[model samples]
Target: MSRRRVGLTGNEAVALAWKQIRPHVVAAYPITPATQIVERFSEYVAQGEVDTEFVAAESEHSALSACVGAAAAGARVLTATASQGLALMHEVLYIASGLRLPIVMNVANRALSAPINIHGDHSDTMGSRDAGWVQIYARSVQDAYDRTLLAVWVAERARLPVMVCLDGFTLTHSLEPLEVYPDEAVQTFLGEAPTDGYTLLGGEPITVGPLALPDSYMEFRRALAAAMERVPQVLEEGVRAFRAHFGQDLPSLVDARGTEDAEVALVVLGSYADAVEQAALRARVRGQRAGFVRVVTFRPFPTTPLREALGGVREVVVLERADTLSGLGGPLGVEVRAALYDLEVRPRFTDVIFGLGGRELRDEELDNLLRAGPPGGVVYLGVEGSRVLELA
Candidate 1:
């Protein structure tokens, strides 16, 4: 489990990890940032290194639908896509979770299109937030690989699909040296998927995907909710197991720096956290007592942990890369605010939206944004017709 560096782009790292996991089926269609994932998996299949069925699905919807079939047939299944591709599969996404299928997917976070730009943004995943899947964000190429492996363990254990998210172009195309783990270690950690006569070939003839009446429908949805509620606990256990095998524990809710006594805090998700951390470091050196909280687990939304982390701060800035345009609120910002609503001593909260359509954000820009915002206010970063100085 000792660390050794080997350079790789985030997509390459995920592909390598998928190979190690040895899923029974892979159904994918090409999309930027995510295309490399399926391409590398296809190569593995061609080389006979992987024993899985690689289905070149016609569309994103088909890819997920295929995964649904494979998973229901009691096969370990995987798929990868982004943006519109993810959007197309939106319906099946809910089905994957509601049916309690243990399919694992890699979502290369990207902006959805009318003008059609393919770059890193949370729009794709954020749009599908209610699909009843557990989502985990990756900050680096190494994280991409490690999380993909963990996603399988979490999904199968909980019998719910899991989305392993990576910032498009940031980690997807960015190269970094990563330590590749041995296959045997991975197998030991993930263990064998449970089998109970759910297999397609099993003679017991079990039924799946049947219509549910109003009485049973609510109960099924409740079951899905209960499974999601169990994710945080299972995630903690998964991290412990991963640490035992890989020697590096992944943070579940918040990754913190200088938060113990900080008066001002920046809360963000995904690769943006790297910039926020740098800004926080500079602020700390200047005796500003600033820190950051990175949301690694998005779907069961980590409300309790976030509230505890930001509760003592005098000022809290919620930075989001995705916009909830219909509601005119940043998705992460709105969620963070909701989490703090019941606290007696809530921090001064601000919403700062930046880095949309893959807009680049520098550390200095983050520092300035933090400085410009007032306590208990929402500030739009990098917006036209706004008084805030444009840092780009």
Candidate 2:
């Protein structure tokens, strides 16, 4: 039950977790922000620290395709990517998830390029939301490590692929104090490399990812949906096991802070939630009753918990780092509003889009925005001129 406190970047911490699990195979291509994860783990492979088959594929698409093959053949698999790398793997993402391969991936969330920015945003992962993989966002280095381990167990139990996303440059590269658990603790919690159900090797002949025409296609999809419905239950079981083994709590889905008695709540995801929490405290000092909720698990959308967290609040502002360009608002804004739709007395909700392509929002600006309460319409924080978007 011993833990070590050390300084490591989010990428390093995640790699350490992979090292502890020592999966049967890891297939990845180097990409910005996320490159270091595979880069560092490659070192582990060279040193023979773990008996893993490290495959350095030529491209992201090839990397993921390799992972799908390995996972289908009953080998525990993992991979890493960001931005366009993830976009390139678009087709395979569905293949991996659709086949219910328990292939875990670490995504360094980055803004997709047009101007070729190599910084943090939710665009990369959010774009793949409908691909059917379970998505978990990490807010800190320790979160990146702990959740990566949790994702492995969750993926195997659910027989679905999982993505552990950390903000690209922000968390992936930033050094922070992290508490790392012993290898035995992680191994015991995750169990051996799940050889029973995942076996595609030396087993009865089976068709993997077989063609399903109209009539049968919908049924297969419905089964996938059923698996998604069971994620919350599986996630809770993993959280409880993690807490019992490591003596640390991993709050499932969303993490709520100071929302019980507050009148204003700021909802956000990833490392930026810390900024909102700080602003909330500052607003509270001015007697504004502000609080912040960080959405840790994005996929399968934590509707019930989110509704309960903001149940008492009068105003809720959803701050999304990506534009999502839905012609409506950001993805998170739409989800939040819909989740609270059934409430008897709904809070005044506003969507504030910010930090696209890695734009930074100053602390004073964030505090001022929170203190001022929900704006009249869609506000684009930190963009030049015209903060609110008035759709004609």
Best by lDDT: 2
Clashes of each: 2, 0
Tell me model 2's lDDT, rounded to 2 decimals.
0.90
- For model 2, give the 10-residue run with minimal summed lDDT: 383-392
Task: Estimate the overall C-alpha local distance difference test score of candidate 1.
Answer: 0.87
TM-score for model 1?
Answer: 0.97
Q: Residue by residue across 291-325, what tens digits does model 1's lDDT show?
A: 78999999989998887788888898888888888
TM-score of each: 0.97, 0.97
**lDDT (10s digit) by residue, model 2, range 1-392:** 78999999999999999999889999999999999999999999999999899999999999999999999999889999999999999999999989988999999999997989999999999999999999999989999999999999999999899999999889999999999899988889988766665356845776788789997999999999999989999999999999999988988899998999988898999989888889888888988888889998988899989999999889999998877676768899989999999999999988888888888867777776765556745778877764532221
